[model samples]
Target chain A: MAGAPNQASLVERLVFRGTRIAALVILVVLVAPMIVIVPLSLTSGTLLIYPLPGLSGRWYEEFFTERLWVQATWNSVLIAVPTTVLATTLGTFAALGLNRLRSRLVPAVAVFLITPLIVPVIIYAVSAFYFYSRLGIVGTYPGLIFGHTALAIPFVVVTVNATLKNFDANLLRAALVLGATPRQAFARVTLPLILPGVLSGGLFAFITSFDELILTLFVASPEQRTLPRQLWSGVQETINPTIAAAAVVLMLVSVLVMLLAEWLRRQGRRIQGKQ
Target chain B: MERADRRRELVGWLLVAPSLLFMAFFFAVPIGAFLLRSVDNTDLVGAMPRTMAEIGGWNGQDLPDESLFMALGEDFTALPDITAAASLGRRLNHNLTGYRSLVMRTFTGLRRHEGPLGREALIAIDKRWSDPAHWRVIQQERSWLTPLYLLASLDLERGPEGIRTIPPERRLFVDLLVRTAWISIAVTLLCLVLGFPLAYVMASSGPRLSSWMLVLVLLPFWTSLLVRTTAWIVLLQRNGLVNQVLERLGLIDAPLTLIYNRLGVYIAMTHVLLPFLVLPLYSVMKGVGGDLTRAAAGLGAPPSTVFRRVYLPQVMPGIIAGCSLVFVLALGYYITPALVGGPRDQMIAHFIAYFTSTSVNWGMAASLAGILLLMVVVLYAALARLVGLDRLKAR
Candidate 1:
């Protein structure tokens, strides 16, 4: 569109139109399944086919009342809460350290810090199974938390690290120069500036651990089953309407998390603007 | 002042120390320890210490001496329980087929020894022991470490002669690794094909339309992977909406096989990974100002020439970054393939899971993990060289 419009020949116009059509088709393919599934989830028919026999909240009610589903929801929260806390704390520190260290080794150190994200999670799941089995913690909440936290930290690190890139180090030094203690300067200046990053990063950590299935498959016992693991088993059993309802519930949770993250990101950009 | 500077840097180190230690212990070391299993012989060496010590002096040409047989008998008796013996048997079975039953039969035979457990007595319990191949397996795994697992991962084995490929029927991991790479490359290309234009559109559109498109992409990105996978399952089933719609449109009387196959995997994986490409490529395209293209057009370059010469080069980093991300992510993918794919569609990750869980074969799991890890690192190194690491981080 920004090119010399008058000089555009018929062939160029055709190519451009062709590309736009392709893009539209791909966009529909990308988003269509998500849209179609929501209505399917609301359909009362036991079958997952289209043209629902009726409309009802029966499946959603079953999702709430089901023993396995309820247990999984609780387990997901149990693991995700501690995972978010531990990851956000440790990851925030990693971000803060790497941001301020002013060392030549930062890139390599950062890479090491984020390798958990880089490596395929299957590797993590298998290794974690071996590691936790030895520690006698594999089936326990603490074990799943440990595994999820390790995996989730990289997400936090990447998110907070990106935010830290926008952070001005002079602000910290300014506070310090004004005779506030190092701790005081950090508490007053640095933490607030990066809180949005930390909160959003925590949301990412929560969703990551929340949606995680592979590690839970290898690490968690039936007693420790999480939402994704349950969905996996449910789908493995059959693609019943109840499974679709479960998926919708899971999707809604992630959507809420995403909106919250987007909000925090906007607030972060606002802070950046004020700076 | 230098002391204060030192103190400040020390604070940075202190801040970083906990996570580094945590990650090293929980992440790196565990992975290292598990991967070490690919070469570890603690199972063998620990199970038969007496036999390992006694067998050291025996010549490879003959069956080991009566003393070695007595030592093996003693080692079998010395095991903590039948399960320990069984575990040892399983490990030996990996080295050579049927060693599990042989070891188990010998362990039971030793328990009911009629007299002195000499070479003759052991041979009577299991006639196969008279053969030198079984003894060779013991001698091979006598060390603190062995390459049996790692070699097996590539479908090679250590014959007395040297390393050679296993029988074609037994050869699996090599093909598995290749298939994983193939599938990942296909998915990456698909993402690039589907995403490049969408990303271009998102970058060039008006703010309102652009944000809407961005939401469409980000919605899937933010949605649960399992949910999207489940959607595909519902939508692609034979009696599902896709087939029904196609039929209503008179496309086919019979519903085409869609789910639980390669086509389904590609469709689901491309949809899942497409955003990863589009988001990064979109940012890169947005950052690529139109001035250069406009200038090139004004200077009489054709649209195609201007796009190729001016626009494409500027967006190369984004393309490289996005493609590499999608490809790498696809390499170790498990869930979508496991659910939507046929047995043939399962990737190396599926086997990694299988070996870890189903067969309880840590050696195979670790070996496969090690090989998969090597592939990822090599691909990452090659791609990092292309666009550098920071562009990946920016994505």
Candidate 2:
């Protein structure tokens, strides 16, 4: 302590404190807008704003009981569940293959696969509108599901590949040396070890499909309207308490999915740390 | 041994085949088909085959001969009444405006006539037929393929002589493109100004504090985009919370017009894209610690000088990566601007969506998308040149 004198002068200290305060304010700016809606949704007033007029359950009742909102929620769930399963399965297999490929072109292939994330959503929407209409699948559930699965597959690949990168090949070799067949080794040893990554990837896929708007806007029909689609129309027509209500519900699902993903990530780290 | 090695390679390929095939069919094919549409013009030739064949032989300077008009009349009478006429008119309107209704009216008059259809008869049906400019449009679109949409997307068009910029009053797309670039640059700069200090603090703080701040950032990342955008509307609209707070504090007599404008767009977009900048910059800053700055201070350099010379240069890669990411995303933004921006404040993407969904102008839509995709690819190539492409993978 004596050897290392106060290197930061008073002016520097003041600037440092100012930056910390500003950073905290920025953090608040980031989180408060999303969290503030929870209280705003509960307001009895018809308008979407702060300062509660009163407390009521009317908006929540509308979100639950209204035919359009309920149908959209159901459609989103229907599409998202299949999207999660399909994208997770395909993306995990692709990641598994990529991990063992030993090719210099792996990065290029990965970039090609993730173009959905890099390219604008409007482009995808336009493409889907054109192709699906030709196939007569426009406004159909399968068409919407296919579009979402393509978009979500990239996220699944990215996360699962990250987890697979640090994985030890020796474990599977050991399982094979123990007289287990290759399939048995994969099922009994590899699958269990990477199950957290797979699950987290699936959760990410689900959230992406659930919150997706543009693809749904292009491919979905009235019967196939998802929650975000409803919210979009809701926003365009009127900014009311009902939208805040829907937003609060959507936020709850997102937070739960996020927490699950965080838990899975930590669990994967712990398992790797143990080895 | 060679057979076994080949078998293993086959197995590896098999595992990856399904996703690749899916992307090729669903992702690659559709975009390929779209890009092709920008230059593919078969609508007029398919609709008015005889007319196209007749016009192909006619000279450009004069009105078509009686033979070409006779062929056009036969082509018109050979088609269904309302749909084909309207469709041809719409297709030709891309080359020459108002040809749609002209073709429609001509079709209706031809349907009611009982005389020989020739050049004079066509001229009597509509005075527009006598104008050589309309014939030029027809001749221009006579081919099965044309670069009209592609040229028009850049606010340029090919006339009798050569390619030239469109009239100043009609020049729109170039302005939209420039505006999109300007807004994206502005947002990127704003994010840097707001995010750099935060990333620095996150990187320099203790592990526990840094992780907490990381969660603060990730919470927004995990939140739904629509949820965040809607929250902005609530906070920024005229009757919204922001104005309410300002008025409650007696800051002004009236609420500011915050939403539905460029200012609103910047506020919302910056909030949405800030985490993108912060996360990458944080990783870079965390890698290069304060040791260098401290060492520079010990060497008698001032704090500002230490930061400028020692710290900032080291983080150039991160800054480039983050800005390029933010800028590219900002250029293609659809939902945020569409929801918050006024008519004059709309970006290129909004117009792209408009042409696709409302106008059903597939050629124009593809052309606009092609221009956008070209811009992004060039930027990425520049990024790859500056920073190795693999570095983007880490981000």
The Cα RMSD across the true interface for model 2 is: 1.2
Q: Which lDDT tens digits does candidate 2 get at residues B1-395?
A: 97877776677678788888887778889888988889888877888888888788888887788898899889999987688788888988988788888998899989888889988888888999999898888888887888999999889999778999999999999999999999999999999999998998999899999999998999888888888899999889888878988899999799999989999999999999999999999999999967888899989787778888998988878898898989999988999998888898888889888998899898999999999888888898898778865466557
lDDT for each residue of candidate 1 in A182-263, tens digit (9 for 90 to 100): 7799799888888999999999999999999998998999999998999999999978888888898898898899889989
Alpha-carbon lDDT of model 1: 0.90
Cα lDDT for residue A274, model 1? 87
Residue ranges of candidate 1 with Cα displaced over 4 Å? A1-8, A177-179, B389-395
Off by over 4 Å in 2: A1-8, B389-395
Each candidate's interface RMSD (Å, one decimal) is: 1.2, 1.2
| Number of the top-ranking candidate, with TM-score as the measure | 2
B-chain TM-score of model 2: 0.96
For the candidates in turn, chain A alone yields TM-scores of 0.94, 0.95
User: What C-alpha lDDT do the candidate models reach, one value each?
Assistant: 0.90, 0.88
Per-residue lDDT, model 2, residue B248, is 95
Q: What is the DockQ of candidate 1?
A: 0.76
Summarize candidate 1's per-residue lDDT along B5-57 as a digit string, tens digits: 78768888888877888899889998999899888888889889998998879
